[model samples]
Target: MEFKMKTEGFHIELPYGRLDISGNEENGFRPYQLLISSLAVCSGGILRTILTKMRLKVDDIRIIADAERNPKIANRIEKVSLHFKIKGSHLSDEKIAKALELTTKNCAMVQSMIDSIEVCKTYEIIDS
Candidate 1:
């Protein structure tokens, strides 16, 4: 991917559309936002797939990510907390926990950040 410099930030042309990235939020999407979003979506997608494979009827899945950044160290991300709100049928706490474990183990984004970023996951099951 090539990033072309704009007046305020850099923009990359993807197949779907253009993505603008910048340090300032008003200019474009922040780098940290994209990083956390990538990790959150990757794990969420994996968890959804795992639940489907387990034959759980899923209506929807929503993931919320909270990232802790250390200002002392170039504002680097230290940890990420992910909360998943899942609306489904026949879901048990035990099964959801196991599915989350599997998701953490298998998610490429989580694996990639294992050495540097601390990732924590929690979930709530909503009746659908």
Candidate 2:
């Protein structure tokens, strides 16, 4: 599968799938938001799967993503922080820590930006 993006004499092909997503710098989801979105989705997906695989009951999972964007330079994100609120019964801190570690290690989007990005996580246990 191949996806293509072409605009104003620039073109790039993505080989992941035919699923193509294209937007300009002015769109609702700016280029920086897209990057953050990718990271959030990757981590969230992995976390959900890992929790389920570990037989942990999840009542609800919410991930709040925040980033510090440098408005001076094309609105680029300098640092990212993710607050994960997992609501369930009898959840263990050890398990949550392991899940966070696993998600950080396995998330492709986060790993890709490891060189130029700072990812922080805060876990919270909420009552359902």
Candidate 3:
């Protein structure tokens, strides 16, 4: 991926569209927002696949992610908390927990930042 410099930051042309990234929030997407989004989406997608393979009918999956950043050290991300609200049928707590475990294990983004960032995952199964 090649990024071209813009007035505010940089823009990358992806197959889907163009993504603008900048330190200022008003200009475009922030770097840290993208980082957290990548991790959250990756885990959510993997969990959805795992639940499907387990034969659970999933109606919808929503993820809420919170991150802790330390300003003293270049404002680096210290920890990330992911809460998943899954709307489905015949979902058991045990199976859902196992699926979450598998998701964390399989998600490449989570694994990539394993050493540097602390990631916590929790879930709620909602009957639909």
Candidate 4:
């Protein structure tokens, strides 16, 4: 990861694209927003891998993520809840529960912060 300081804030060059982060709320991505999005997508990818290995076909996976932050004590992220919507066929709540259990255990980002942050997961399986 390479970061260059710009007049407005900073430009971080990543594999996907250049991430412009600034204090200006309307101008660029906030640092905390990046962490929240990364956590969601990282978990999403991990879940997809697990499902494929289990021979389950899925049409789409939507990860809706939100976080609670405390600014009084160093602006820490207290908790993150991820609501997963999996669109597929013949999917059962039992299967998803197992998959999510593994996802929480295996996702690198989740594992990194599991001790510090409350990572809660819920799911809905939509038959397609």
Task: Report model 2's TM-score to 2 decimal places.
Answer: 0.76
- RMSDs, each prediction? 0.7, 3.7, 0.5, 1.4
Candidate 1 regions off by >4 Å? Answer: none
Relative to the true structure, candidate 1 reaches a TM of: 0.97
Clashes of 4: 0
Candidates arranged by TM-score, highest first: 3, 1, 4, 2
Stretches off by above 4 angstroms in model 4 are none
Tell me how candidate 4 scores on lDDT: 0.89
**What is candidate 4's TM-score against the reference?**
0.92
Provide TM-scores for the models. Answer: 0.97, 0.76, 0.98, 0.92
Q: What tens-digit string does per-residue lDDT give for candidate 3 at 36-105?
A: 9999999999998999899999999999999999999999999999999999889999999999999989
lDDT of 4 at 108: 88
- TM-score: which candidate is best? 3
> Per-residue lDDT of 87-114 in model 4, one digit per residue for the tens?
9988888888999999988888988887
Clashes of each: 0, 0, 0, 0
- Higher TM-score: candidate 1 or 2? 1
Q: Where does the lowest 10-residue lDDT sum fall in candidate 1?
A: 55-64
